[model samples]
Target chain A: MEITELRTPCLILDEKKFRDHCNWMKDKCKRLGVNLRPHLKTGKSREVALCQMISQEGPATVSTLLEAENFFSWGVRDLIYAVGISPSKFSRAAELIKKGCRLKVILDNVETAKALSNFCEKSHIEIPVLIEIDCDGHRSGVKPVSPDLIGIASALTDGAKLVGVLTHAGDSYGCVGSKACRKAAENERDSIVLAANRLKEAGFNIEIISVGSTPTATFAENWAGCTEVRCGVYCIGDLVMAGVGVYKLEDLALSLLVEVIGHQKEKGWVITDGGWMALSRDRGTASQAVDYGYGAVCDVNGKILDNLYVKLANQEHGVIVNRTGEAISPEDFPVGTKLRILPNHACAMAAQHHSYHVVNDGKVIAEWPRFCGW
Target chain B: MEITELRTPCLILDEKKFRDHCNWMKDKCKRLGVNLRPHLKTGKSREVALCQMISQEGPATVSTLLEAENFFSWGVRDLIYAVGISPSKFSRAAELIKKGCRLKVILDNVETAKALSNFCEKSHIEIPVLIEIDCDGHRSGVKPVSPDLIGIASALTDGAKLVGVLTHAGDSYGCVGSKACRKAAENERDSIVLAANRLKEAGFNIEIISVGSTPTATFAENWAGCTEVRCGVYCIGDLVMAGVGVYKLEDLALSLLVEVIGHQKEKGWVITDGGWMALSRDRGTASQAVDYGYGAVCDVNGKILDNLYVKLANQEHGVIVNRTGEAISPEDFPVGTKLRILPNHACAMAAQHHSYHVVNDGKVIAEWPRFCGW
Candidate 1:
């Protein structure tokens, strides 16, 4: 069935663009002499991950046991549990390792590592693991110079072999342009490399040194010590990337195809059936220079109004507040007018919908399904 | 299992409180001498709808076709597609009507009505509809005094029967308390009644008079001209109700239970696994007197700290900013401390998750599955 006929408030993903994005990342890795083990936390799709596998050659970074299991089931042999493995997930990690899955869990604390060690020893599950080093204090990971890092490594090393160190400088998302992004990426690489050397000086053989973020991975000039780079948003750029000047509006591969359900002519609101349901509540662009309140509003022909943005949104209702002209209330665009909305964050917005109607040249050729939850 | 034991970043619904809330609204309808047909848009779950169904005979109000179809499949006979119906959804409405689904659709334009009429006539489908009257300058609905109303109704009432006139005072959400809310409710009722009277003068018998919104629904003192009332949010009341002083914090039936996965003790930031994913992107409480950035940050024991709130959120990361503390950081909470977050809007937050862990006495007795999409 044609996409236009399928109804509004639907997810659309382009296969050609998705593959091109994957190839672009792969080419960058080949030039840098590093492995491109893209993260699955961005697009939790087996098909998308398959592209990453084709490009990377081996394991990919995962945030959940579900993702690890899904990718493993798809025949991706090596797995890197990117996030800090909690006590609850230790058993599941052991189970996957016991089942012959080549899983390398991440650790950042002595407490978590001690628990993991106990579980592995009891379950007889030998697993290779990496220490998550904090590069820029974005979310989780131990500080590069923290004394607790060595303590945790020693604790977890009883049953799990320390493969190397990993770091994700998520704060690089705040960089204004490619130059700033490259600087941030360099800092990210240096943070991990320096930490690896410190551990190496302490008589530790660190093989894998990883650091990644879409902006950093795409713009980083030098990769002195990085072995693997983990980036995801490059596969499906969003408004956040556009705000950071990393990617243009045209480069964004995903959008919610919505209909002009109603309009508020008095306030310049173009209401659409696509609410937080189709487009997730992730306002990643909020902290950016241009806060696309929710997202960029476009016309039926996918033409974004230069003076208009969705200022406010309700459940299944979007208020497109125009910066110019008389306020066009919900009356302006009567009904059944199609529109394409550029999302704040491609990952979260895409996660809201079940499947993406892969579109290219105004035609939806296939539908790719996405899975949710841990 | 206790909610605290379940994984962090989970939705917990209080069943007993939900039942009580339903009964309270039902009793209010009995006192007002109006049929209480609730708007199920707030509690999108059929489980919550079935709980509310205990009050009215069966059937309910829905914002989307998916909800209507779900309720219908659950043996609900009379259903109102409360949201505006565009030409695109005409076929879906016609099919439901043809299958003996007594569904009433709402429309605001002659252009749309003409299209719907043509489709219904060609398909031999006698669809029942309600002329949507705008009680206030809020969201969707045609103005009661709009000249286009009569013309659109006359054109569309060919194969379709206009059994009612519906108007919702969504502006009631802005009102302070019962007095303001009551006035808004009266305005909502009066606007629809006036439209119905106008239609009656034009020889159109308007049988059903619908008016709703949680605030207005609760304080609607006079529904003399209305036959049925539609109110949704009161069942699973949210922070909006607390802001309007309609309900206390303890009265709220839904909350997101998250765990402290990562913390910044120096910065007073407590990062959880539930960023926009589990808690939703709806900052409904952002506008309230006490702006809970995402939701009111409560301790493990469910006690809300007026001094602390989730000030900033990223994908799977919530920064707990303590307003009164020297440095507000949730990292102060132990790595495994579980916390409860009361969402700003129950409707939007509830839609983000797949299912609800039905809780009673702080223990999860059963799990209710939640369906999404149209």
Candidate 2:
């Protein structure tokens, strides 16, 4: 099937760009001498996961249990359920572990740790767990020097083992330039390494030290104490990555294939079938230096259209307008004209669709399915 | 099953509220003497569609062909593919028409109208088409007064038939107060009625005159010269609707059931399993009179937690903080405590999940499946 023949408002994965990005990240990890546990949270496709994996041996970080199950079914044995485990999901995690999937769950609170321990004891399972260390006060995770870290570690008494410390410098995404990103990366590395050292001094076996975020993984010059890096969005770079100078515009591997259905010429707008439902409602780049409203408009061949951006979007209709306030003629972009849209955040945009029409050299090479629900 | 037993970060549909909202819209349409062709674009569920239908006979408006097909399978014979029709979907639309589905496609451009006409001529099936009228300069649609309106209508030849004019006052969503919403509704009613009159004068039989929007349909006291009012979102009220004064907080039918995962005590933040992936990245209420950061925090029983809002969100983590910077003790809302969140936009949030866990009087009554994809 050809690219144009596929339905409009569907996700298009640029195969060549995707492979290039994966290879680039692999090379970066190799140079840094850290195991690259690519987060499957971005693509959530078994095929994409295979491309991201260091080898078929299978070790990956998944944001949700559904993703963990998906990758495990695809023969990914070593998986990390990256989100903090609540009591409700303990049995589900135990079920996956019982199925011979070496799953590792993470948490920062003593209550959840004790709950996991209790669940493990009842289920007769020894589940490996990681303590989430907060590097930049971004989202989840405990402070590197928090006294409760030991309490959380001690609470893992029955069948729950303290595997290591994990930290995600999500605040690295907010860093504007290379200097700031590098600083955030250093902070990320130091905090996790500090937590690891503290655990070691306390006589706990801190086997793994994991830290990452696409921005930090790409910009961090040093990964001395970290044994593995977890990055997801780097495989499908977006405007947010570009905005933070982690990846260039040409590095973005995902774009929404849409068609111009109509035009509001008076407003210099050309309406397309892709809207928030297609492009996603992620305005990640809104606070960045360059705000691509909805998404940056690109031609069918993946060439960025100058000054044209998806200015506004309804459920299934996107209004593309020229940033220069120049009127766009309806004759110029007639109805049925196919176009590509580079999204603001690849992860969020990709989540909107079930599968991607993989395109290489303007032709549909394959279709890769992705899992969605919690 | 109980509400607390269901997984975290999942959609919750309040059955009683949903039935009430649907009944209210039904009565409103009855008072206006217009058919209520509830747009299924919001709650894309067969059961919800059945409840929203004026009669079991079923006539609705869908934003995508996938929705039309889904509803068609559920015995919804009449469906209007409301978004502007492009050529690529012509075959799919025709396939549905051939299956005894009275599917009406809409378009605002002459090019697409010609393409539809060409496709119908070749397919040997007369497809009903509606010319989209721009009620407000918000999104897609041709201006009602433009000569291109008749041109687009005239392009329908061979197997394509011009049914009437359809317009959605999407800008009414931006209106803060009832006065502005009523004015927008007036514009929506006038523009579509004007287009219908023009088409009639040009020797065309205008059968169905359609105009609507949630805000407009809720506030519009007048619906003269319109055969049917197409409105969605009102069926599943949200923070965006509440922000516009269309629905009160209690009227919202959909809420996200999430678990408290962790906390940032210094910042007085309580992190939960719900994030943008669950609540949606919509921020539709950001520009409204009251900005709900991500979503409004609610108790498990559906009571609003005053001043507590989702201040930050990651892919699987939402941080709830007090608006007045008051500290919340971790013990007060411990880990594993389930809570509900009212989304900013129901349509966007609903699209993130696969199904809604129906709750009534604090119990899981049913699980309603929702289809997503295009």
Candidate 3:
């Protein structure tokens, strides 16, 4: 089936671009001499993960336990639930582990560590955990040099095992060029390595050191202490990634396919059935070098329309306008005209859809199902 | 089940508040003497719609054909798919109509009207349509005074029936208080009523004149010349609605219940597992009078935690900080503590979760399933 035959305002995944991105990340990991535990948070599809993972029965990174369960059911065994685990998640993690998932969890606090350890001990289940390190003061993680480093690890006494340290250069998204991204990468490496070294010196036998973010993973010149890198969004580049110089617009595998319903001619706006509901309200590029309002406009075959972008989006309406404030011809995008939108954030956009119409050579080859929620 | 025992970062619906909001809208529509065609785009659940809808059979408004189909399956026969109709949606709309759904579609262009007319004629299905009017120059719609109003109406020649006119005061969301809201409401009423009068003078029946939006519907002093008022979001008040002064914070029935996962002491940040993935990427309140960063922080008991909000949101992480920049006490919100976040837009936040945990008093009484995608 062709994508045009499918419903408008739906997710379209370009297979060629997706496979190329997967190979690019794999080659990058190989060149850095580090294991690739591809983060499945971006594309929560077993089919996508199969092409992204290092092996069939392999190491993968998941943000939610639901992703862990779904990927495990699809036969990718070695997994790490990358988000900091709360006590409420312990039972679900244990359930996955009980079902033969080589699953690992992470945390950055003593309370959670103690609770997880106690839950594991009581449930008679062993769960390996990584102590999250705050590299750039981004989001979750303990300070690399803080006293809590050893406290969190030592608190994992009974059934919870402390394996290593993990850090994400989330702030690398703010970096514009490769120079700044490389520096952020080095900081991510040094911070996690410092925490890992501290754990090693304390006789904890830190086995794995993980660090990544699409920008840093792409531009990093060094990965000395890192044994593995966890990166998502690399396999599905977006306008934000393009702004960060991680990849070009040609590398974006995901796009929202929409049909022109009408036009507000005097205002030079082309209204489409697709809105923020399908495109996502992620204005990640708003603070970047270039802001593609909601998303950059593209043709049905995925060629970027010169200066067209979704300037405003409501629940079910996207007002496409020219970036240079030039009036758009209504005849150019008449009713029933199919158009593609390159989202500001691929992860956020993909989450809005239940399935991806995998398009290959301008035709939909398959429908890959994806899931959301915890 | 107690909410404390449930998972974190999930949608919570206050049963009392939801019913109250539903009843409030019903009473308002009754006092105005107009049919309340509640828009199901906000709460896409059969159970929620059963309460908000005028009847189980419904005089409802939907944004997508999927919603029309879903509501029809749940016994809502009368629905107007409120978004402008694209030609691609004709077949699905026909199917719904064939299945005993009194489905009406809206459009603002001659191109769509012609295509829809041809498709309906070919399918031998008579689908009623409403000509959309640009009430506040906000989004899609033909200007109420535009000549294209009659031109598009005339283009609908065969099986597409011209019912009347519809308009939404989408810009009313920008209103800060009731005075501005009332003005926006009057403008909405005048625009649709004017378009309806024009259609009537042009030899059209113009039976169903519809106008609404939560803010406008709540403040409209007059519903003159309108047969029905279409409003959503009123049944699920959000920070955006609160900012518009349509309702107080206590009237908001929807929230994201999240668990405190960790903290950054010196930065005065309490991190939770709920981020944009749960709270949504909609900062709709940012442009309003009072900006609730991502969402206002609330305790598990549904009481607002004054001066606290989600300052930053990653995919699965929300950083809660004091609005006054005062350091937060980590002891006050220890790990595993449950907190609720009031979303900026009800429609965006509810789309993130697959189901709602319906709470009464303090315990979860029911799990209402919801759906997404088109």
Could you tell me which residue pairs clash in candidate 2? none
Residues A332-370, model 3: lDDT tens digits: 999999999999999999999999899999889999999
When sorted by TM-score, best at the front, the candidate numbers are 3, 2, 1
Worst ten in a row by lDDT for model 2 chain B = B54-63
Identify the runs in model 2 with alpha carbons over 4 angstroms from their true place. none
- lDDT per residue for candidate 2 within A1-374, as digits (tens), equals 78778888899999999999999989999998999999999998988999999887477899999998878888999988889988889888989989999999999989989888888888889999999999988888999999988888988888999999999998888888789999999999999999999988888999889999998998889999999999999999999999999887877899999999998877778999999998889998899988899999888989988889998888999989888889888888888899999999998999999998899888898999997988
Tens digit per residue, CA lDDT, model 1, B348-368: 788777788888877799888
Instruction: Categorize the docking of model 3.
Output: high
Writing each residue's lDDT as its tens digit, candidate 2 over B242-306 gives 98889898889999999999888887789999999988899988898888899998988899989
| Candidate number with greatest DockQ | 3
Model 3 regions more than 4 Å off:
none
Evaluate residue B261 in candidate 2 and report its C-alpha lDDT on the 0 to 100 scale.
Answer: 92
